[model samples]
Target: MSGQPNRKFDLALTGRRGGNVWTIDGEPYPDANPLSVQPGDHVRVHMVNHSPVVHPMHLHGHFFQVGDAVQDTVLVPQHMGEVTFDFIADNPGDWLFHCHNLYHLDAGMARVITYVQ
Candidate 1:
């Protein structure tokens, strides 16, 4: 956990009513832009939830500091204006970041964080 981030990302979480689709920053999983970082970079993510359901966002391979706590998963309440967190990119690999809700995950609410040399 660090006070300043070398890179930052702003994401909007949304879902289509009655449709089997979910999106992040207007793009569905496998299509969402990959978050790229160097191994030592400090990263920050700002998320806004527009859907009507809570989204427990999970990140694999890294734990982020939210306020005073560190966690791998954070609950983004429905209609929340924003939530932000930061993490150090110590792991050098492609990692998954997604909504933990199974249906949402299956519906394409996911993206990848890639660490590059």
Candidate 2:
């Protein structure tokens, strides 16, 4: 996001054995570690996938600019693949950001974006 995002987050996606925990930034789901933002804030998420599997990242409550298109979900290929998306935090609430893959999500890959006052 060369437009200079007001809020920036770097997320890394990976998987851990023994419970098959799908992790974001190296932690399981219900991480309780939310990304805080304000309404109208320009947010950018730079995501990198370290696993050898594709991940379709989804953001609830807002559409994001990926490449030249605006969509809520974008795919990040495996093996160090990266994706950068930008969005305006217009919705006010706690939204989930996670992999669209039901299995990965059920395993533990997710985060909450909390809109703070």
> lDDT tens string, model 2, 12-89?
999844447898998778964999999989999999998888999999999999878999999999999999999998
Task: Write one digit per residue (lDDT tens) for candidate 1, span 1-117.
Answer: 546788999999998567699989879888778989998898999999998888899999999999999999999989765789999999899999999988898899999999888
| Candidate 1 residue 102 C-alpha distance from true site, Å | 1.0
Model 1 — TM-score against the truth? 0.94
Candidate 1 Cα outliers beyond 4 Å, as residue runs:
none
TM-score of each: 0.94, 0.93
> Local distance difference test, per candidate?
0.90, 0.90
In every candidate, how many clashes are there? Answer: 0, 0
